[model samples]
Target: MQIAKVRGTVVSTHKEASLRGAKLLLLQYIDEEGRLLPKYEVAADQVGAGVEEWVLVTRGSAARQVEGNQTRPLDALVVAIIDTVSIDNRVLYSKKDQDRK
Candidate 1:
């Protein structure tokens, strides 16, 4: 799994039947220090993560392991909504802090 931030939502008028009800979100890869990378991807939301929230992303075949995504044509999936991220015993990000801004 990798860390990323939800940047936006994706809406498609036409999609595969298996992905009909899935929510697709745009995400930007973030490093351990919480800096955004240039890479971006669209992922199927499995945990209902919202925009600006930090999320855990699973890619490739691993993304297909999520319960409802098994048969869907998904290469990435948001598996968790992160509340806080800590590294080297330091807190890099916290949802509460983001909410205050």
Candidate 2:
């Protein structure tokens, strides 16, 4: 699992049958300090995350499993809303910061 910032939402009229009714969100991989990391990709939303939300994402087979399906074509999934993130006892990102920004 990794942390990412939700960039936006994806709308698809056509997709795998298993993916129907699933929310797709664009996620930007980020560092511990909450800076954007190198890669960005779309993910299935299992936890109802919204745009610009900092989310915890699971990857690979684990991601698909979290959605309660094993055969779905998914590489990532937003599993949680991060309330706070700390590094070296320093707060990096938090819901409070989001509210302030």
Candidate 3:
């Protein structure tokens, strides 16, 4: 899995039957320190993640299985909304930052 930031949503008027209720999103990969990394791609949203939100994504066959469909035609999928990310006791991200109230 990799950390990514949701850039935007993808709308599809027509798609395969297996992907009927799936929502696609554009994601930009990020590093452990929350820094935006090079390369960006689109993925199916398994969890409800919004633009600018940090999300956990899986790729390849693992991604397809995450959505509960082994035969899915997806290469990537957002599996979770990250609440916090820590490395060696250093907090890289906090849910508080996501709370824009």
Candidate 4:
């Protein structure tokens, strides 16, 4: 899994039948310092994360391991909405802090 920020939504008018009703989101990968990386991903949202939210994303076969998603054509999936990210007790990002800004 990697840390990523939700950039926006990806609407698909036509998709595989197995992917029906899935929420697709555009995500920009972020580094350990919270800097955005050039790489981006379109992941199926399993956590209902909104734009700008920091999320935990799992790619490849790990994404298909989730219940009810095993047959979906999902290469990536949003697994968690992060509340805080810390390293050595130094908080790098906090949802509460972001909300206050």
Write one digit per residue (lDDT tens) for candidate 4, span 36-100.
Answer: 99999999999889989999999999889888899997899999999999999999999999978
Give the whole-model CA lDDT for all candidates, comma-separated: 0.90, 0.85, 0.85, 0.93
lDDT by residue (1-101, candidate 2, tens digit) is 89999998789887788888778898999888788887988888888887778899988877778536567888888889999998888887888878888
Cα error of candidate 3 at position 6, Å: 0.7
> Which residue pairs overlap in candidate 2's backbone?
none
lDDT of 3: 0.85
Candidate scoring better on lDDT of 2 and 4 = 4
Query: Model 3: per-residue lDDT, tens digit, 1-101?
Result: 88999998788878888887788899999887778888797898888899889999898887877535678799988889999998999887986776764
Taking all chains together, the TM-score of candidate 1 against the true structure is: 0.90
User: What's the CA error at residue 19 for candidate 4, in Å?
Assistant: 0.7
Candidate 3 stretches greater than 4 Å from native: none
Clashes of each: 0, 0, 0, 0
Error (Å) of candidate 1 at residue 36 is 2.0
lDDT of 4 at 5: 97
Instruction: State the weakest 10-residue window (summed lDDT) of model 4.
Output: 12-21
* Model 2 Cα shift for residue 49 (angstroms): 0.8
Clashing pairs in 4: none
TM-score of model 2 vs. true structure: 0.87
